[model samples]
Target: MTAKKELLGSLLFAWGANSYGQLGLGHKEDVLLPVRVTQGLASIGNIKCLVGGGGHSAIITDDRTIWTCGSNAFGQLGLPQHLGESTLPLPIKTLNGKAVEIAAGLRHALAVTAEKGLVFQWGVGMKSLANRGLQTLPVPAFMSAREPCEVPGFGHVKVKHVSAGAYHSACITDQGWLFVWGSNKYGQLLSSDDFLPLPFFIQPHHFEGEKITLVRSGWTHIVARTERGQVYTWGRADYGQLGRKIKSTQDSMCKSNVIQSRFTPEKVPELTGASQITCGSEHSLAAVGDSILSWGWNEHGMCGDGTEVNISEPRQISFFRNYIPAAIGTGAGHSMVLCRSAGQSGGDFKACPEEQAVCQGNPETATT
Candidate 1:
């Protein structure tokens, strides 16, 4: 009679702009409400994903280990060296546990390794402030790894998923192909080469054949999702974040009509079936079916629609309607929703100003 291994924890909750503490909730302020986050993440057993970057926050758990927290400056929390900031949650241990999938950006961070998926990357690489016309400022064209290296040529290329925006990085090859590398500025790596540096596949007739299972990144924009559920999108359409709409093209070298910025990929017919998708820094989210759909840069509401205004297309949030989402996250402004109560089994996290504030718990007592 020896059977009792049901751990599987949950219940993490966090809120908008945690300054540099990145909401691990130990300090650095800015949370605005929903807090929990349990210090350095209790014992770290269940959380399989929760990434929020720009200030930093990783966590990958399920024992595959990763757990970072708040700005390591340019090292992007791969840890080691001088240790700039960490509002708690440490554990990088050289990714020995195997880290399944991870992504974070605006400083940089990426991972993916469960044996052959092998990806890993580290901070600071940007450069291409929109072809240097943003009027200056945007340096560090390379600093790739301060710690967890291994992003060579993909060895044999197994990578399942990986994304990091603001600066750039992407992966997705289990067969679905997709690749991509750093900073194409607003084109988000559809590549006119503002700064590609390495990994660059992205061509299966521009996804018209349908394969990519999922992909996400924003700060510049990109939202993939195809296996039939459709959804495409491409980089920085000003503030509308490419949720569809931005199509003025007559500039055969400036004959005149040029609104540009999407650069390539389009689709997003309203996010087709969207099972789940995320991005923030400019805003984007999708869950569909039970409903969750949002669009670009809602000022500070992060597209919750209570109106800070930006949203160009999608829109359906109405507070999750009744709750069923399961998981979805985004940062750089804030948005997180791990739901449950449709019939109830216990799980509800929510964030992003759905009014007064709610962060209830009980993921089986929030294990430790």
Candidate 2:
């Protein structure tokens, strides 16, 4: 399949498995071809931003509107009640007004808002690493069917951006602080082992010094890019997701559970100048200026090089050197990118007016 995509006049491209019309290509068949997703709803000109998970998709319009399709097993689509699955991008109710950015995980959703000035989550609910329990999540602060508040000390925190791991969550707020919660089994929660709190907000020592620029959460590890162009990682190092090989040196100065398990945030050996970031099921991808870097699992070419060999440490993905990447998105096992262009708009092709607008171009960075 020719998966090369160019940003031109607001166009949307669909490739890979499409069993649920999640590809929005009119049918429920896998798409080995680069088909345009211009359909009944998207034609009105929305051309909003688009993100894809394992088998689901999310689209946000320029007007702060949100739409979702595909699997809803855990209410990841933010629909009123569980709808099972969707064949195409469907408008989500009450999701408008002041949305700045949106992110998706294997079965969860996250968003940053203006008025609320915070991060919100909903979906499969992240499981607890200590208690080993599962709960539904709504984002900025953990939620239930009744209340949604702040993350303890992070009260009324205005989020700058948000990201999600397979079962965890991360965020950077306007206060120049990074807060992580949900699922810390492998220390993906970036906290001490014994200090298990119910979706409590804790700051990582590695995030000190300068303010952060961007943050990306992966399945088991999390990476962040700062204004200084330095990339930092924490959480789950069993697979070398921290971008360096470590001999598993976890020290628990605090917390009683430290005796049983050691969970501590450590810095990646030698990585710098990251311009963009994204994460897959168990691997990671980033751009240092124009250099593409991949780390962690590469079983299915998820590393984006040309090999299936896993990269426990960092490796250069020297595929798109000449092009400067603008944006990035990752699915359960694949990745997508957007390149900056001159007067080019990723064309919109949906059937309805509400779905019409300027759509974010899906980078053909391919599953590699």
The prediction achieving the highest lDDT against the true structure is 1
- Residue 318 deviation, candidate 2, in Å? 5.1
Write model 1 residue lDDT over 1-368, tens digit each, in one string: 10012112334456667677776767887654344466565445556566778888776765667888888877888886647888777878875438767878888778888777778777654533433533354433334465677676788768777888887778777677888876675777776767766689988788787677677888778888766667788776767877878666545665222335366777978778566677877887777766888887776666665667788888887766866664567777766665554666433322221110111111111110
Model 2 alpha-carbon miss at residue 236, Å: 2.2
Model 2 alpha-carbon drift over 4 Å, by segment: 1-50, 127-155, 193-199, 238-240, 248-271, 313-322, 340-368
* CA displacement after TM-score superposition, residue 125 of candidate 2 (Å): 3.4
In model 1, the worst 10-residue window by lDDT is: 354-363
**How many clashes (backbone N, Cα, C below 3 Å) per candidate?**
0, 36
lDDT of each: 0.67, 0.55
**Residue 46 of model 1: what lDDT?**
58
